[model samples]
Target chain A: MKSLRTFIPIIILLVAWEAAARSGLWSRIVFPSLVNIGREFFLFIVQADAWEQIWTSLYRAFGGFALAAVVGVLLGMLMGRSQLVAGLFDPLFSGTYAVPKLALFPIFIFVFGIGSLSKVALIFLECLYPMVIMTYHGARSVNRVLVWSAENMGATRGEILRRVVIPATTPYIFAAFRVAVPVAMIVVVITEMISSADGLGYLVIYSLSSLRTDRMLAMVVVIALIGYALDKLVVLARDRLIYWEKLDTYYV
Target chain B: MPHAQRLAGAGLLLVILVAWQLAALRGLPSYLLGPLEIARHFAAALGSQELYEHAVASLLRALPGFALGTLLGITLGLAAGIARSFDELLSPLVFLTYPVPKIVMLPVFMLWFGIGDLSKILIIALACFYPTFINAYYGARATPRILVWSARNMGAGEALIFRRVVLPAALPLIFAGLRVSLALSFIVMFATEMINARSGLGHLIREAENGLRFDLMYVSLVSIAILGYAGDRLLRFSRRYFLPWEESHA
Candidate 1:
């Protein structure tokens, strides 16, 4: 019953959209019919060129997200465990936390060239923050009672970290993943839209420029579906790996 | 004790800058400006009117969008949290679309709102809306039931309890949402300008890149960094001012 209630708004939105599309008071460019959009989406899915663009975007987003996951976990763990490290790096991260890293894209283009390399690097930088911050909070909040009990049983440093610290921090790592995945998609599309020869972002721009509003909307749908799918993948992995914990947050 | 730690932090930053300057002396790419050179260019730009024009243009878009989005987000989110019917009606849609990249709406917004500042501002507002709504929703729902009961026992009316009990409890998280939204506003504003605009810092950097004016590029970079950092500081200051009873950690 609750699940059915949730679908009401979505259904109403779609019906309204279809009605507006059929109204004809507005240009098709502004309100492309759902049927045309569905057809364009089908074409987009079947085309080899479209798949290549999707692959390019997926690889860039994945490459950056994977790198951030590894490095951010390590750095965040260190910062959480060591006060000295925290003092040194906390200000650095939190200080520039609100600054738009997109401002550095031009410089990155000059340094890393106008290709996947620069885009991947920027994505890596952006994803790194949430990962590090969340993981740091997670690791720092691990129960001292657990650590003391483990030490009393003669567990070594490595064992304590592996058994106690990591298990406790797993939930937060997943939270960070939830935040970073969409960010990876956002950065990839934004970078491609700003300046790129290939990727879904570039395709959206290309379609818009050539006055194919249907194709552009189709690309938008594809991008949104990919973003949603990536988020689901993260949740699935988190659920499988951390079966002991419930997904308590509304987002992840 | 804290003072010494702060000094140590400053010392570390100084070390990084000096090291960068040293590396540049050995010769780096022309595209990369050393710390001293960036400072010089920033100072020169500060003396000119051009930087202010671009900065103001960027702010005009970011501020209005941030204000509008957060205001609506907080109001609707609180309403949904406090009222079950509203929650069932609104939250499902918000959560379903939460993971989708909001920036993809830019082109469509351009088509509907026209190819002007209106589209860009609206896009930024749309992007800014999500975080604030989520945070405020959680904040309102997380309020302790005991407190609400106590307020009611004291004969406080519905509006009184809501204003007194709900608002204070939610302020911290709401501020957190605003911080995230403010940062997002700058990012979306920069992106829209970069994708299509005649003016703003993003456009200035694009022109500099095309012209190969390395100094101007660094100047724009420095200006943006300063703006972002300053905006964050201002937000933190206001948070402290408003929530004096709450202790801030990091």
Candidate 2:
């Protein structure tokens, strides 16, 4: 009964979509039938060009995310542990937090070139904010009692950080990663769509321009699946690594 | 001491700007303008109608989309939080699509709604929906059970309990969601405009990029920065006003 309830809305949506497609109220271009979209999706998955586009987008997203995770965590940890560092960098992040970093894309293109480099860099910058902010919060809020206990046990700074601080911050880091991974995907796709010769985003544009709405919808599905899977992957990793902390938030 | 620290912070930024200007004096790419030059350009543009027009266009697209998306998100999210059937029916779908970038639908939107303000507005609305929905949902769900019980015991009806208890409790998180979606609305608005638009800061920047008008590019960038910062401040202020009992903290 519980499982059935979960699928009910999805079933209704699909049925409604199919009905809309068959109702002939609009052109097929506007509402491609599920069967057509499914066929196109199948065709796309089997195509080498589609695989290449997927790989291009995936690598760009992953490259940027990996870079952000490393830098953001290190900087966040530094800021968390040191008041001076926090004082110095906190304003920099928060003040510019509202600014759309996408505004800098044109400059990035000139500096990094109109290739995967620019896309990856933009993704890195975009993903960096959430990671650093979340990790900083987590690291800063590690219980004072835990630190005091660790010190009382004659633990070194390194030992205390490794045994106590890192563990406490792990959950927050994962939380940041969860927020960031999707952002990375979003940036990659947006950048690619804005300027790129190849990638899933580019393919979507390409299909749309060619008036292949069905194929375009198929690409959308592929992009959505990749996004959904990446999110689920992060949740799985978080659960495995931070087993002690159950992610009860709807965010996951 | 706190004032001194803030000055120190500004000092660092000032130093970076100075260094950048010095570097430009030596030699830098044409695409890269010094801070002073950029500021001068921004000032010049401020005197012109072009900047205002584009900024207004951008705001028109961003604000309406934001209002619509947040309104729907808050209503549905709160409903789902209060009712079990709605929760089961809607939440899974929302969560599943939560991570999917809604920008991919822009082309489809353009196809369906025409390549006009409607498409841009709808895309922005779609992008703004997720954060607000999730935040509002969590905010309502996290309402204190004890408070609800007390209200019930006091003979308060369901509507009364919701209005007095749930709404207030959810306001903070709802504000957080609004803050996030406000940022997102600008982003999606900028992106859609950049991708394809006749006017707006994004379009202006794109034009500058293609025309190699570094001054115009910087002007547009500064305009967007100012707009975004101002909108954020406005939201923060409103949040404080609405939730007076909740302490203002970043």
Candidate 3:
């Protein structure tokens, strides 16, 4: 029953989409039939070079994300643990938090060239803020009582940070991942769409330019699947690691 | 402690600026401009009519899309939160596609809606919708049921309860969503403009890049940055004014 409930809305949307496609009111290009899209999707997956495009996008997103994770956590940990670090860095992140970092893409392209490096760098910059802010907040708000108890047991500062602070901050780090991963995907796709010869985003633009709406839709589905899979992967990891704390909140 | 912290942050910023300027003085690349040089270009641009034209165009696209998206998200999300049938019917679809980048829909939107501002506006709306919707839904759901019961016990009406109790509780999360979507609106607006547009800061920056007009690029960059910062500040101040009883922690 639960599974059925989950699929119900999806079924409705698919039905509505098919109906629209068959309505004959609009051109086939405007609303490509699902069968056509599915065929293209199948075709896309079987093509050897298509996988390369997917790989290009995946590497850019993950590479940037991984770098940001390491740097953001370290920086956040430093800020959370040391007042001086927080004082020095907080304003930099928070003040520009509202600014669209996409503005720097032009500069990044000039510096890093029109290759994947610029996209990766942009992703890193975008993902860094969320990770730092979330991790810092998580680390800052760890129970003082727990630290006091650890101290009473004669644990060193390093031990406390490793054992308690890290575990406590893990949930928040995962929350940041939830935010960052999608953002990385968004940035990669946008950057590639703006400027790239290959990648799923490039494929979307390329197909559209050639007026192959079905192929383009197929690419969209591929990007959507990869994005959805990455999110599910993060959730699965969080569940396995943070078993003690249920993710009850809808918003992080 | 707060005073010292402010001083440290400001000091670091000053150091970075000075270092950048010194680097420029030592003959940095043509593509790079010093902070002062960039400032001078921006000041000069400020005197020209082109800056305001592009700024206005950018805001026109961003603001309307933001307003439309947030309005629909809040309304639908709050409705879903209060009613189970609507929730079960819609929640799955929303959550299912939540991770998918909405920007990919731009091509399709263009094909269907025409290659104009309408499609761009719709795409921005689509991009901004998710965060606000989810946040508002959660906010409404998180409202204390006891308060609702108390309101009923005190003979308050349904609409009154909704307006007086539910909306207030949901405002914080809604505001959180608003901030996210607001930032998102600027990004999507910039992106759509960058992808294709004759006028706007995004277009200006792209044109500058292609022409190797480094100073013009910085001028557009700085303009968007200031606009983003100002929009964020305005939203924060409004939140404080409206939700005075609630601490503005987030």
Best by DockQ: 3
The C-alpha stretches of model 1 lying farther than 4 A from their native spots are A247-252, B1-4
- The 10-residue segment of model 2 chain B with minimum total lDDT is B1-10
> Comparing candidate 1 with candidate 3, which one achieves the higher lDDT?
3
The model with the greater DockQ, 1 or 3, is 3
User: Comparing to the true complex, what docking class would candidate 2 get?
Assistant: medium
> Can you tell me which runs of candidate 3 are displaced by over 4 Å?
A248-252
After best superposition, candidate 1 residue B160: deviation in angstroms? 1.2
lDDT of 1: 0.90
Give TM-scores of the second chain, every candidate. 0.97, 0.97, 0.98
Residue-by-residue lDDT tens digits, candidate 3, A159-229: 99998999988888898999999999999999999999989999999999999999999999999999899
Per-residue error for B173 in candidate 1, Å, reads: 1.3
Better of 1 and 2 by TM-score: 2
User: What's the TM-score of each model vs. the native?
Assistant: 0.97, 0.98, 0.98
True contacts kept of 2: 0.62
Tens-place lDDT digits, model 1, residues B1-250 = 2766667667888899999999999888999889998899999999999999999998888888888898988998999989999899989998889899999999999999987889988999898899889988988998999999999999999999999999999888888888888888999999998899888898898999899999998888888888889998998899999899887654
Ordered list by lDDT, greatest first: 3, 2, 1
Query: Docking category for candidate 3?
Result: medium
Q: Give the TM-score (0 to 1) of chain B in model 1.
A: 0.97
